[model samples]
Target: MMLRPFSKSGSFYKGNLHGHSSNSDGKFSVSEVIDAYKKRGYDFTCISDHLWIDNRFCAETVTDASKYNTHNFIAINSAELHTRGKKYDKENLWHLVANGLSKDFKPSNDEENIQDLIKRAKGDGAFISIAHPEWYSLTFDEAIMLKDCHSVEIYNHASTVKCNRGSGIYIADFLLNENVKTLLTSTDDSHSLEEDAYGGWVFVKTKELNEKKILKSLIKGDYYSSTGVVIYEVKLEKRLLKLKFSSSNNIMVSGAGHTNISSHGYNLTNAELDLENFDSPFFRITISNQFGKYAWTNPYWFNELDLD
Candidate 1:
């Protein structure tokens, strides 16, 4: 069953959910990161500095609030959960990206479970996602097993470069799960002043520019993912799911249940294909450059409630 393509009714804000700054291990400051995304045409961004949740109230709260309002920014109030020991000389820790948290919300190194971090985030009305799963093996499995992780970064532009792409860590997860519902996300994890940092984005459809509306749509799987390629449209009305590309480059649309067509590739001159009986409830898209580096859309669900 094929349905009409989804059309954009209003403006959509391109955003990044994972970003770093000097508040953590990143080389830049929070304001500097925001300036970079704004200059690059990104409408919104979240700063999840490692192990340090930037509680706006601690220092210069009034000044920071003023700056945020002036820039028209939607800061999600986020932090990165460090699973590794706190001491610098100790073993490393697993990291989870979190937001909408209180300044007092603290987790011990013994409480390294990703689920616990997610629960805390959600309990406080925060939207939670796993950051840079490809960087560490422990976090990658935790991402797959955790129930409420709204999404995970299949591509982390900065981390991927640092880890040399993590030995196909995430691709194997997709292959193992027969009923996976989480959407794939790409984030720049940008700390430096670079425009094309490989991955660093969340595709969302929301007319209102505030934090509540955008975050709601994002957790509900209302958008796709992209590195550089723009997805002009994606819709599912009948038994068919149609995707439209914003460029004439090569693209591929494949999924778990439709004819078992794994990794189907096609060159795009504005092409469209009918996916029949896509009843698996999980589908994704990929757009790649000639170099095989690409962006992957998180698994779009057909008819399932996200229980996390």
Candidate 2:
């Protein structure tokens, strides 16, 4: 059986699932952001401006950049939602990114917690992600509380270059170890404050380049997050896993605590691993090139694929 992303049928659409604009604290306006992303060769982009009450860095309304949609490039309505009651945040706020949201999505008041916020966003037809967990120091308790969300922000480029804590690898693995069944995401979270835009993104597969279809594909784990590497395909048969991709210095399979298998070579474009006795309920793949760019696949469980 082919792993999903590969199992799904569609053209791959390159996109940034998280970003900011002048509607929030970002430097550029919606149109400027659109022009910038299109110039970078993105098929679609989300203007996920901050949706909170803090006027200094947030707006109460979601950003709707749909007017800039053309025959090829388009914008998805989105917001970087926030709420209160967290252990380690400086502002005690939880950062959640919601893509394909309706413009009327409400802002969180002081009383709303993360769970309530997630439920409301999902009910409103949005794909939600736990944003920048490593950058914000989200606690294990906080991650558990949000175990039901669609995905974890596994990589955030803005936080990486700006603060050096752009990876949520631990939290994502921890959630999987806990059997949370969550997906993974990579985002720029760009404010255009520095050289942050286009540094990270997700390549989603869908038949149409519209918001509804993209959101549906995202929720189904029909995409791969990347810093630079591109994965062509993934397939499994008779306990052997095969992957095709661009040149990479390292390719590895990561699983439950301390369980990892790897193969390394120069300009290696393909590799296969025998998982016949690999000791883990779930597995994920990682590829990194010489320039330090990485690509990650969402965890797939053995039982879910009827292989366990």
On TM-score, the leading prediction is 2
lDDT of 2 at 236: 92
TM-score of 2: 0.98
What residue pairs clash in candidate 2, if any at all?
A: none
Summing lDDT over every window of 10 consecutive residues in candidate 1, give the lowest-scoring window: 57-66
Using lDDT as the measure, the top candidate is 2
**Model 2, 217-267: lDDT tens per residue?**
999989999999999989998789999999999999999998889999999
| Residue pairs that clash (backbone atoms under 3 angstroms), model 1 | 1-240, 84-92, 84-93, 183-298, 184-298, 187-199, 187-200, 188-199, 188-200
- Per-residue lDDT tens digits for candidate 1, residues 1-308, read 22111344446678887776666656767787777767777777777666532343122111121146344556666666655432221345555676555555665345445456567667866666666655655333444555466666667777666666533325434642646556567777766666434365776777677767777777766666666776666555454445566443555556653333322344452444455644455556666654455555555555542222
User: Model 1: how large is the Cα RMSD against the reference?
Assistant: 5.4
Position 64, candidate 2: lDDT:
79
